[model samples]
Target: MPPAPASRHRTGRRTHGLLAAAEGLATAAALTAALPADAHDGGGHGHRPGRYQDVQLLSFNDLHGNLESPSGSSGRITELQPDGTTRTVDAGGAEYLATHLRQARAGHPYSVTAAGGDMVGASPLLSGLFHDEPTIEALGKLKLDVTTVGNHEFDEGARELARLQNGGCHPTDGCYTGKRFKGAGFPYLAANVQDEKTGKPILKPYWVWKKKDVRIGFIGVTLEGTPDIVSADGVKGVAFKDEVETINKYAKVLQRQGVRSIVALIHEGGFPASGAYNYDCDSPGAGAGISGPIVDIAKNVTPAVDALVTGHTHAAYVCTVPDPAGRPRMVTSAASFGRLYTDTTLTYDRRTGDIARTAVRSANHVVTRDVPKAADMTDLISRWNALAAPIGNRPIGYISADIDNTGDESPMGDLIADAQLAHGKELDPRTSLALMNPGGVRSGLTYRAKGAEGDGVVTYAEGFTVQPFANTVNLQDFTGAQLVQVLKEQVSGANAAAPKILQPSAGLTYTLDLTRSGADRVVTDSVRLDGHPVDPAATYRVATNSFLAGGGDGFPTLAQGTNDLVGEDDLAALGTYLTAHSSATSPLAPPAADRITVVQ
Candidate 1:
């Protein structure tokens, strides 16, 4: 199929017209339906026939504000073959993505663009510094209708997010009016998120829209653990409710109002399948299996809801599972940072006021740079780049060596860990070795001389780009046994009997023998702390960022630790630590590797 057209579909800075028109049209119908509180429920003044012939739902999740393409090698999403070797694919960025989304929207009478969550926050400097305003603008040009509140959205707090949605609190130019920031042409939904006192969703729970004869409902929800995951200050008064309950309650209301078709835009996701990171619906086998709270919600959500779109895991896939009614429930998620586009076709039955079965088709398409940039999207990204150029373009720091992501042990990973340890040590004297997770390193350090431009200079902008999530630094005390358990998770699969043991950061290193089966892959026999054999019964002070400490990366061990020091934003701590101790003079050393010894 030919690629989708670019945002250039609409020209000029006055594009808000398109957005306002879309929302005005949708809201008008909703207000009309919501009014006359006495209107016949379901029989509402003689079931005004449906409007839309068929609706197309185009979604992207976990954008992380990479309005421009990002640099760095992601995890090896290798398809472990029968022969033991693996195949890999590189993914990411937004410029090339516009073309894919445009293509995905073709032929549908009413197509809506939406994102599950993490569209911003933990963003690259180009979009991060302006508080991800550029991302809002980029998504604006793309014509997004509604987005769920992901954990990352609260990085700056509810007030700041509201600023991003409506307008900013400051006199700054892009502070308030979302138009100024390139926000989606629509409002954000928080169906499961409620204010502590009012008990109503802090943000609108769901949005009802009219297209042709169809009354389509779009409901948005963030993960229930949002408060626990976001910065403590960002979610002070809000409470995330049960996803299934929230959706069911709203689904019933929409059903009574004669709205039958529903699509959930949520920010939670499942586990990686096999060893590959990307997934497709047509692919054979189970694809990747889902875990966590989302799986339960998707399985139990009111059958009235026709489709569920999710994000937050950042993996890609298009899959289906049976809902409460035994009907196939289509669920999908695009990879993070604008690397993939998820398209789901929702077919509504005009005659029965219901959604058609097997009519739902969803797919996750990779966004490759090889494709020509849509003229208009390129222009949108260019304009934002121009606005952010001075700060993002200016140099701040430089690297003396190349931090290649060839293996588990790399200089970049070590540097990140050291920074975390340094930050943690200041907060608590007990902090000894910092354990950084590889998933947290978004970019790599470039090796360059004093004047080499592309030589990979590590600047302040570059630093933030590497660790953009802003996860706080946390201090914890774990018994050597628990610490070992955390270490063992690196090799655990999502379906593994125990927690998946992902790689840990440097304290003392040892070899990991993949051949050693399950938890045995962690060569605990060779593991050490400060060059001495670790006593499994002993306790140790471990320093890690809040995400991992909070049990992100599937490491529940961190959560069970003794002292829980909160409030240290990882990115801030990294920046502060780097500036205080290092200069261009600091030498970058690769984290020495004794782990992962592959045998012939």
Candidate 2:
């Protein structure tokens, strides 16, 4: 679909720059004073009564724990063009985004800023070394109203996740204990996350914030499959519950407590396309990509729910689906990692005891570098960067080449897969090939100039920060036939006929013909073992991370594999491999593309 007309707003160019610089300097002064800003919605110079009568809910998701400026990742991201071809955009770093968020909130009354999830794990060196406390402090400074739980929150288990939210559980000498984090002004709600023993939810179900007479309720929920997708050890005791049931249960409870308007902060999303599947916007139902469980929840959630704010799939969309009452139910999501924020305005009807559906209007804000940073948020980020300077900035090793993710065939992904294959063979020599999910490579590696500066550079603290979630390595046995099925899974979408199996790493070679569609596109039947064809019935040990071993990224064939050899740390394996193989040269090699083959 073509982009809608841009909103009308005008500001003096040079004056805005000067004003932004002044704001940043003032924020630095405020940080030194340790005096936080009182919560004030930039209203249109007046007060209002009722839920969403004059309220703005500002939200962003998938922050990934970037507390300071750091190198970002690569990909061919599309920018919805109003009239021309969809333009490509680069993704990354939070500073430029913080600038944008603050500026966007200028002059909006009752504006509540929050996140969907993935805020503080799989971080960069500047924040992850201290267990994402810096990011926490930054959020507090930003005055976030609420946030839902994402799967990465379980990186260090429930205890650590709680520590990051509440306070550290360990003593002062422990890793995350002494860090300074401004506790959230609003609670972090995990309505569906439950404790197995008590059958009760783990965190607060919802938060009710009143700006004068307007009562706004925010409910948070993680995806039901969070535990399964996370590393087994990371979430051993906790259980994720039915999303729809949990929301319905909580909506009534909040309503009973006198909150009339409710919005779901769920860490789940739909896939959306403009033209064709995974292409441009040309069809209507593309906004419905966020299917499965979330679809059921959206359609059946109680009447009290005014809007559904969602994430996790990292797809962008905005549309109104129908609730059970045939009422127009608004569902919106900003694409992941601070890329976009869906802006929706809700109007409360005084006569009818519910939000006016026709009065609801929504738009997505793209976090671009063009905007200026809010003073308070920028200051908070600066303070955290100062605290993390000594630990994160220290050097660990060096790389000569640029670790790029600019294409489907990413160098960083290849490097990670190589690490998996090398480490898997060590644990069990039966391992032949290692498969990695593209979504798992959160950040890229950038090597500094040969003779640049400090001794402690890109610390082990940094590398792990790049691959923070301690996903275990698993060695599973699979027949050549099953492996072939795995390759076909990649082109299952409309691109299926295009023969694009995304990009797998070295030690594997494959071909794909763009003309064919779906499974048939993977036509070449030859399977190789060290440059020789192998029997389709032959069983081979396939190496992969635990998440995929249990069937993550739609790779079900991995679960059927046998002889699971589990190793605790995937990041540790990569770090060791990098240090041992550091010849000041890039360790990644181009893919052989063996597992997949296609013919036109």
Candidate 3:
């Protein structure tokens, strides 16, 4: 399809840099005095009548274009009950999310809806088929005030992201609704992402929301290591700067503008000690219950920023980490897939133009399905589903039982690896084994029918949901020694902090010892293929997705393989494998996921 005729909009709100230095210096001095005291100590004076304003900031992250209810574990959230036990609650879907946000905003005239990033990408067929135009449109209806760009926003590269922000029909797919797409209604902030050549931010670095003197400035940034995880072409010509430095720099700019109350919307987040959405991460004191990169970034960020809204790790938490001055500041994240949302109360001190950190409070709430669906959202979903039905409803295969994507060695991951290996053999008969990155396998296959499809039947939509990245199954040749190094890379180097386990095909097996650390975690002596020990000097053909071929997800060794030959799309390969292996009468059963000998 040709490019849309509509011109692109200019980059976000800009401020003059020529503001008087003396005025800026004076403003900084005032800001220092106006800011809140030690939040953990609760030192602020009692709230005076009409002196403060309660600003309701509702936030969520990683929607991932789930216009409809997500299936399997992706649609559930753990809830800590009064009985001191946890229970899973069915949540998510744009209809329910819309209702929850709208209901939460009631009675609060000064409310703002924001997101941490990844509003789209790796989506279900309903949204992904139309290039996520449905999701962007749904967000506009959800009243999302602002958001940062997550790594997935670069899935199709910068130009595509720009088209999403500025209205236009997809260059190739064209408009789905017979009308020009009007882009996103809210600003997509990218404080740390810069144009390499010009040293300028590609999107708005910061955005301010003001309702009669109640002003709040937001600085958005994804993880500084975005390039390491995203495909090279996705982030071409752009530089991801240090998160702490970028946020701090923008804090000064907002401060110079006399916008004292600031919030950092960061795409990088931490893992809380507890998985329950209602877990009080701050109960153990400040940020004791959570630990990850967000902790360090929060601790190092300038005290000028009052709070941090974060995502990416997709763990739920409402914690507080001390600022540079050792004063407690709020840090929060909502679990992904529209399953949960964090509601934060920022006590805006109108007199001082800053938030009273001592009065800050936050909690994550499930987007429970008990409530009635938002009618408008229902209409929007139905409209898109109608368009998607033709391609989505077609039967692709059958399953005997649920094949879930969970734990270190997921059944779904195993299935995908086997499918890729089969596809690889078609391109190169010498292909011996296949390895799949856990991140690429998005969801699982359930035997139960989701729509009109009968039990055990799998539709093209379900398969697309499971493997939506459109990565190619590529074949490469590698020495056995290098293959061993690739396995070690999963637990060491860039992936040391959080391992990215590579799922292996049927013929390949090894022992993973959790008791060990780093590269030693992979029991080298236990490595084998087809019951034969992997000799260091021997050469073997390996099959992996194009993303892994380019060294994504901390697997740099995979990028070094020689004689690359790209096969069919990973999803197509999976469909082919299913059709060849099973039928309605004899459906495929879930893999045991017992290939890896895990020893604690």
RMSD of every prediction = 10.0, 9.7, 9.4
Q: For candidate 1, what is the lDDT?
A: 0.64
- Model 2 agreement with the true structure over 1-600: per-residue lDDT tens digits: 111101000000000042232121101000011111322223344653332354677777777665544454422235544354555554334666666666667766657776788776666655665666667767776668789887777776777677767764333436443544444455778899887888787788898867655677888998786764566566768899878888889989988887877888988765454411123221244234334345667788877798888776655556566677876666766665565565566664433444555566665655554555556667666666666566545455556556654344467667778778888878887778887766566666655432233322345545654565556778888888888887776566422322223335455766656476566555545445566555578888887777777765555666788877788577777776776666344443333333444444
What TM-score does each of the candidates earn? 0.75, 0.78, 0.92
TM-score of 2: 0.78
Each prediction's whole-model lDDT (CA) = 0.64, 0.61, 0.84
Higher-lDDT candidate of 1 and 2: 1
In model 1, the Cα lDDT at residue 44 comes to 35
lDDT per residue as tens, model 3, 420-500: 999998888899999998887888998789999899899999998888877788899999999999999978898787777
Q: What local lDDT does model 3 show for residue 133?
A: 85
Best-to-worst TM-score order: 3, 2, 1
Q: Residue by residue across 400-489, what tens digits does model 1's lDDT show?
A: 566654455556666677777777778887776778766566666656432234554556567667776656677888887887777787
